[model samples]
Target: MATDRRDRTPTADPPATDDEHAAHLERSRRVWDRWSDWYGTSESDFEPIREAAIDRLDLQRGDRVLEIGCGPGVNFERVRRDIGAEGELVAVDYSPGMLENARARIEAHGWENVRVLRADATTVEFDDPFDVALATLSLSVMPDIRRAAETVYRSLVPGGRIAVVDIRSFPSGPARVLNPLVRRFLRWYANWNPDGGVVDALATVFDECEVVDTHMAGTSYTVVCEKRDAG
Candidate 1:
């Protein structure tokens, strides 16, 4: 299996300071911008898993779909296609390069129903709730994982569905014995990851949640949450 390079980077001191957050976003944009053209192409190596994540949306025509941290709009097109002419698809991400790449693809695909925007997942507003929402592999990088999950929970309709998948942090038996040293190193290189607290946090918002799938190595997991109907 391919290891996520992002996980190996030490979380910066103080986790994510204001200045550090700004620099993090800037660095992300620069890094993505450099890979814009090949952003969603097969050479990217994430295309297959990306498609799988989109498939979890189970979109229907006329449905309202929102994608948070939509990198290069890889899965946006898939959702748009599923929505057909009557539905709406909105994609958001903080990285300018990601938005640019996503916009280009939306145009190339002639998907007028799809809209891409540059916005922070931690705090973004939508005109109305959506029928389905997806935050594939993106929420894991958020600086405020809890607030972001709340935002996502709030963005859904009364009985909407949310699919989230990402790499979470866990301690290895040997690594645990190593003490704070390992955690100290991780705290410096990584940002607020969704894969860690989402399972528990989501339980508070959604009526019921289930871990739908997981990588054999336990490095990543996918979960589905449903918003139950009102009383």
Candidate 2:
């Protein structure tokens, strides 16, 4: 088994005072801006999860897709492929550095049907509704999970699908009972992203939802949601 440092290291950041948390978000933006230079090197870890999202979406030709917080544009091509050669894709992320990576990927691939934007995920607005929307691991760091989920809901067309994959304090079934403990231990680790829990926060916004155990040593999960008629 390949033991990845990002996976094995804790996910919860140290306890942050409101000021510390604000400063951290600012630092996070700068760090990822620098990471744009090394974006491609991070693709290996992204492939599987990207594939999972594509497979689960099961899109058709000409489908319109929206990706929130699309770091380094890792999944743009895959989503385009899923929608077929004629489909359209719109990807947004808050970091200019990350958007730079995303733009490079799109340009490198010569994908003419894609649009990239440097904007916060919570406030992204699409020109038109999409057939499907994805937040692939991006919402895990969101400061406002419910608001973000609502924005996703409003961005989609009727009966459109939305999927979010994120990391949790624990991995699976009965073992998940230890999340509180795991969360406590991880709080002391560096790089711990302690944004309030997304899974629970999003439950109030979607009508149909399902969660599945994913990769990274079963430490992460994917949540698939369907927009309601009224939502």
Measured by lDDT, the strongest candidate is 2
Give one digit per residue, the lDDT tens place, for model 2 in 1-231.
Answer: 112222232343234466765665565577667667776786777667767866777788999998887878878877877776688998878778888778878889889999888765666677788899888767766555666777888888878887777766755677788877777654432233555667655665665666754666677777777775754
Expressed as tens digits, the lDDT of each residue in 7-106 for candidate 1 is 3432321345678667766655665566566655643455565566667768899999988888777676667778897999888888776687788888
Backbone clash total, candidate 2: 2
What is residue 196's positional error in candidate 2, in angstroms?
1.8
Per-model TM values vs. the true structure: 0.75, 0.78
- State how far residue 68 of model 1 sits from its true place (Å): 0.4
Indicate the residue-level lDDT of 12 in model 2.
36
